[model samples]
Target: MELKDRLLTIAKEIPPGSYPVDVGTDHGYLPAYLVKQGIVSRALASDIGEGPLLAAKQHIEALSLSDRIELCLCDGLTGIDLSDKTHIVIAGMGGETISEILLRRHPLTQTLLLQPMTKVETLRRFLLKHGYRIEKEIPAYEEKKAYTVMLARYDGIVREGDDFFWTFGALPQSKKKEKYLYFQSLLSRLEKKQKGLQKAQTQERTELDRLAILIAKAKEYLQEELYDHHSGNL
Candidate 1:
């Protein structure tokens, strides 16, 4: 099964030899692809709805992977056991839903591959505060939309109040170009919002003040990237 750019990015993050548990499996294409590629010996595909789960089952069978991939119909990881899985892939969900899934009890030892569709800042803050260390982030552009894939693990370290990384991300060196584009896009939206709020006389003006700070910080980081690469030559 061929995966989309976002899903493919998430797939590539899965470590080899990992026994993966794919949450919100939808049609189970990811697990099928992983198994077909020989990245993992086996996997568990799960979804909350019966329809999706049934669809996943059929897809797995068609691939003749029924013996390799297990299908479970459940909500999040509520009733599942994590001992057998080394990594968990939760993608194509809103950040809030991902946060809620993590909020519930689960094995801290399992690495997480998450791709939040919206409210990523909220998800990043939650992960940092909850002792999950983001090891790396990969950016994927598909269908004219940019997506972020995060690989994180429980390291018992809490990072707090880093708005720049929380709003954008502290991308790995390999993804510097992606990081620059993300920050640039974010800066544009924040600047426009700041301009609108500046014309208002309400207490909301405080938001504009906050936006100024964020705008300045994002610009500084982006400029630093340019100086580090181009130097006086630019």
Candidate 2:
């Protein structure tokens, strides 16, 4: 089972020998890939809906990974037991949903690989507030759309900040081309929003000012990264 770039990016973040439980395992390709490649001895794949779970079952069976990858029908992690798993992948979902799943009474001690389709800022904030630390972020491009795969671990440390770090990301990303382009794309979006709300109310104006500052700061960071790359300082 070949995975797309986005899914592959998420899969690569899962450590070897990890017992990964893929939340919302749409097609189960990730777990199948991991098992087939001998990256992990076993995994648990779960989906909220019957349709996706059925498809995942078929895909896992076709790859003959049924024994290595267990399938479960559950909402988030409600009906599944992750006591033995060390890694949890919550990808291809909205940031809000991912945050909610991590909050579902399960101990957030597992390493997490998250790929939020939207609202990455919200997801980052949630992680910071909930005592998780993002260890690394890798950017990938699929069909001209950019996606970021985040690897986080539960550290029980509540990160505090409301700056560009929260909006963009922690500094020193993997230094890939797509990573640079991802921040550029974020700058473009912030600029557009700032312009569109130029004549907004006082509260909106404050938000706009913050976006402006973030845009400038992101530009500076990218320039420094580029310079370091050229000078072999990265």
Candidate 3:
């Protein structure tokens, strides 16, 4: 089975000649792809539940990749063991969940590929508060959903001071129409909710304010050259 563009990007980040572990691998697709492409010599496919574990096993068997890929039934790195040669991928989860997993499994590995389904800011903040350095972030929209997958490494001290770092990673500010229009559309939607809604409440107000700030900052980044897309470089 072919992987999505976002998943492929995460897979490609595993370096040219290295082994990687796919955490929360739903169907063992990524490890299989990497092994077949000769990008990685081996992979450990892990999932939290048995349903996905069965699916992964079936896929691996179909592809005859049992030797190249190992399947494990684990919960958020509960029993994960990573050597110095392991690159980890954790997706299909919230940012907080990803952060928790890493917090428990820190000393085992430093290289991490993270994709959070929601609460990404919380994840980014948690990483900074801890000792993780977000090296790279790639944004992609697939299946009508926008996903930001990040590559992070271990550090001893926390990095700080960027307020909008979670929303826009080092992707060059593009006033080139699509990005500006998307931000505008998002702003419009948020405004519509805040304007004449019959069920206006405190939670909605709080969320509306947050979205508004994100929209304004996005505009600022687009209007200026202050876009910070990566963690390592500027």
Candidate 4:
């Protein structure tokens, strides 16, 4: 089965011989792909909805991967047995939902592959404040929409992140071109919000201040990136 670029980016972070559990496995494509490609010996795919789980079951059965891929209908990691070597994948969900799942029951797994559909900064802040280290982030684009898949691990040391870190995470260290595009997208959104707030007489002061800071930081970073590209320093 062919996976989309976003899921493929998440798949690349899974090392060989690692056991993976995909939460919210809509169609179980990721697990099936991993097992089919022999990246993993076996995997567990789960979804909270019965319809999605049934679809996943059919897909797994059609692929003749029932023996290698187990299906479950449960909320995030509620009944799954997580080992230290297990890799948890939670994608295609809002950042707040993902955070709530992680906060509900902390997993013993060492590695996590997370891709949030919206509110990326909220997820970043939750992870950093709760002792997870975002080891790396990969940028993925599909159908003109940008997404990031993050590889994180628990270190048990809580730390706070600045506005830029919360906004972009480790994305600034990504490839120059992808980084530039992602930053530009973010800047555009911030500027649009700032303008709307400026025109509103009832705008919240705190939100306006936050937007200004983010916009300034984004411009500074973009300028640096462009200069480096021109100077052959990238």
Candidate 5:
């Protein structure tokens, strides 16, 4: 099975011996790919709706992976078992929804790979405040759309981050060129929002101030990157 860049990034994070449970598995592509690649012996693919679950079932059956991949119809790990060394994967969902799923039923799985389609800062804030430490974040872009796959683990250490941390979670420190692109994307979004607010002639002071700060930070980061490259320090 072929996986998209976003799903492939998430798949790369799964270790060889893992028993993964893909939450909200749209078409069961990730699980089937992992099992077919010999990365994992078996995987459980679950979706909240019957339509998506049936679609996944047909895909698995066509791939001759029905025995290796199990399909379940459940709402965000509500009835899933995590007693074994299960790795949780929640992708293609909103950040608020992912946060709600984790908040409702905190998994015992050692690792969680989460990919939020929107409101990524909200998800990062919730994860840190609720004792889940973001071990790593891998950025992926497909069709000019930016996405990140966050590898997190429950460490029981609650930490509150500032606006910058919430906006760019350990991305600035990354050596990958995608880090700069991600920052640029955020800056573009914020600039557009500021323009919209200004055009309406009704601006929220707090929001405008936050945007100004983030914009300045992003510019400074890009400036530093350019300087380092020119100085042959990168």
Candidate 6:
């Protein structure tokens, strides 16, 4: 089966030297691709549901890669003694759900390759709060949807006030033209809901304001910081 453009980008972001644990691996294509590309030594394909695990098993079996890829039926790595050499991948899931999985693991993980389908800001905030650094962010446009593939390491806790930037990358560098337009589109959608938001409780308005801050700060970064060009490395 052909990998979708977004998932292919995610597969590409895995470091070249380490085996990865594909959490919630629906079809096992990522592990299949990684091993085939020599990007990883082996793979542990896992999913919480039995249905997906069965499919994963079929994939490995068909590839005749049973020796190289191990399939596990796990609910977010629960009760699994994951090896220290394993990098966990949790993509194609919601940010909030991904956060819970990492929280369940606590402070032990080799690396995290995460791509949240929705609530991306929530996912980034969770990673930063739990002490993960954005190692690399690869951007891709697939099926006319732009997505970000993030490589994260358990570095240290970072409480950034920049509003969920860890999902995209640090604000300073993420202000690339394409991302800027995406942010603007998000803000435009929110503004169109101004009437509904304005009628909401004070707390909801506050939440909307916080979300808007991302676009506001981004504009500042593009108009001002990009031109500075000297205070820090580009």
Candidate number of the best lDDT:
4
Off by over 4 Å in 2: 199-203, 227-234
Give the worst 10-residue stretch by lDDT in candidate 2: 225-234
RMSD, one per candidate, in order: 2.5, 2.4, 5.5, 2.1, 2.1, 4.6
Q: How much does candidate 4 score in TM-score?
A: 0.92
List lDDT for all candidates, in order.
0.84, 0.84, 0.73, 0.86, 0.85, 0.73
Q: Which stretches of candidate 5 lie over 4 Å from their true place?
A: 172-175, 226-228, 231-234
Q: What would the per-residue lDDT of candidate 2 be over residues 1-234, giving only the tens digit for each residue?
A: 577889988887777899999999988888989999999999999999999999999998998888889999999988777689898899899999999998885458888889999989899999888888988788877888878888888888898867877777753445557777778788888888887787554467678778888988888977876446655643
lDDT for 153 in candidate 2 is 89
Q: All candidates' TM-scores?
A: 0.89, 0.91, 0.80, 0.92, 0.93, 0.78
> For model 5, which pairs clash?
none
Error of 1 at 143 (Å): 1.6
Q: Which residue pairs clash within candidate 1? A: none
lDDT of 4 at 80: 77
* Model 4 lDDT, full chain set: 0.86
Q: What is the TM-score ranking, best to worst?
A: 5, 4, 2, 1, 3, 6
Model 3: worst 10 consecutive residues (lDDT sum): 170-179
lDDT of 6 by residue, 94-172 (tens): 9899989989888756877787778877877787788887766665556656666677788776756454454245432
Model 1: how far residue 199 lies from native, Å: 5.0
Write one digit per residue (lDDT tens) for candidate 1, span 132-199: 98888887767767778989899888877576778777566565556666667778989888877766
Which lDDT tens digits does candidate 5 get at residues 51-164?
Answer: 999999998999899998988899988877777746899999999999999888773446999999998989999899889999888877777777888999998899888988
Of the candidates numbered 2 and 3, which has the greater lDDT value? 2
